[model samples]
Target: MMSGGNLSQYLAKSIAVMVFGSNDYINNYLLPSIYSSSYNYSPPDFANLLLNRYARQILALHSVGLRKFVVAGIGPLGCIPNQLATGQAPPGRCVDYVNQMLGTFNEGLRSLVNLLNGNHPGAIFVYGNTYGIFGDILNNPATYGKKILHFLN
Candidate 1:
């Protein structure tokens, strides 16, 4: 992936940029199931794992020459229309535990970005803090602007 971006500079002379979102499958689905929880149902731990993996990927990308890109980490999955639709039951409210996971993940991402920038000279990794931006919208539906409410139902 890094090499492709590097080489694209000559063909089109345009910087080939790639944005990676959500290391969730590895962190949220696989790690928690295998290491933290037995039934594969815990959401908080899964969220943490997702964040950790994201940090690692960012570091790996910086290690290479693919430093002229941004990484948009996981958004507020709890408020996502899909999760809200699926989680509408007795406790139809958005899951706090899941949100917590997102918080941790964002924190880790911020730290990783700072670390990369501080340590590496020409590192251009931008951490898009989507969680903080969307948290309020999730809490206050009336304040929602032109955002599309994602609904699985």
Candidate 2:
């Protein structure tokens, strides 16, 4: 369940910055409520559920005069370096099915944003693309000249 607790804190604290990110799988297939236990719908059947829900939430917030929010769409999950490294196939090969799922999720998110923008005059929803940035880093880590390592410290 997505909560507005952080947003409330931001409003109270007068914070001007907020950031959000979504995992590839989540962005694509899971956002829709169809995948939810409350709904026994399949992936393709629940295609646009997530986007529609997000739009509704945005509109509800806007009705209360809460504007200025950022929502990010998912990125290409199939191309992550972790996926590539773990594969026994050729280099740079991504999992097509996973990417397709993410594509669906992003599509839904974009549709939701469009619906909110079109219906409400004062609604402010900024679409951030965190997936692309992370994907770029994963693709070419050396370009940033920073080595990322995971260890038990």
Candidate 3:
């Protein structure tokens, strides 16, 4: 049987994994015809807005006794199947524009990881390089024992 303090300590040791930002871009920001975000803010501004909220959310978790975190950044949105299906890219390429916008968000996420670790004592925040890892896999699929399949229109 664990006491209240012991239970809290045990819970704190459990790492929390957080991933966000993809749906915001693909479902909201990119759909200017359906959303006003594109008109209200540029890509960089949108990314900043997301990071501000993200920082707060993470802090809220920290305040609740979560001391270990694994925060993953948004991956290459342009390379995803849904984006690729839009037929914006050339025969065998990704939508660079979407990827670039996501890059801004991912970069800010990296900074957020550093900021959280430095500002909060006794708390550890690790940044998952999801963007880099996904990009590498997309760029060199063969190296990872798989090949990207391209479709014909």
Candidate 4:
């Protein structure tokens, strides 16, 4: 058995940084041909499903002494080159429908941070607004300087 000193040291180093869920949308939800997620659950419902699972997983980690978490929200999947290739969006434009759906998921993830922090005293949970950060970079390219590249056919 670990003494309090060793336990505290281990917990201090057990920071968990989780950034994911893009595949759930890009690989599953958007692929109606191969996956039934879109037909089976509405966007909000899907977000709830993911959030519920996320809460359980984080709680499991907390039960094991993980006290710090940095959860990054899903970014703009609509702007992916693969999604752009689908032609559902206009040339050089993102699939707003897909982004909007993921936006619902991101919002829930933000709430999850608050919920976890409120319920677990002394546990630290941070919500990284990657969506907002990425969105700003996409929306105002000039603010960070600009570059354009052409793809070969």
Question: Listing every candidate in turn, what is its Cα RMSD in Å to the true structure after a full C-alpha superposition?
Answer: 5.4, 7.5, 2.2, 2.8
Model 3: pairs clashing at backbone N, Cα or C within 3 Å: none
Q: TM-score for all predictions?
A: 0.60, 0.57, 0.90, 0.88
Task: Extract clashing residue pairs from model 4.
Answer: none
User: Candidate 3, after superposition: displacement of residue 2 in Å?
Assistant: 8.2
Quick one: ranking by TM-score, best first? 3, 4, 1, 2
**Model 4 lDDT at residue 109:** 96
Q: Give the alpha-carbon lDDT of every model.
A: 0.56, 0.55, 0.87, 0.85
lDDT of 2 by residue, 91-149 (tens): 54565665565566566666666766777675566666666676677666777889754
Q: Give the Cα-based TM-score of candidate 4 against the true structure.
A: 0.88
Best by lDDT: 3
Off by over 4 Å in 3: 1-7, 146-153
Clashes per prediction? 1, 0, 0, 0
lDDT of 1 at 66: 56
**Residue-pair clash count for candidate 2:** 0
Q: In model 1, which runs have C-alpha deviations exceeding 4 angstroms?
A: 1-52, 86-92, 139-153
Winner by TM-score: 3
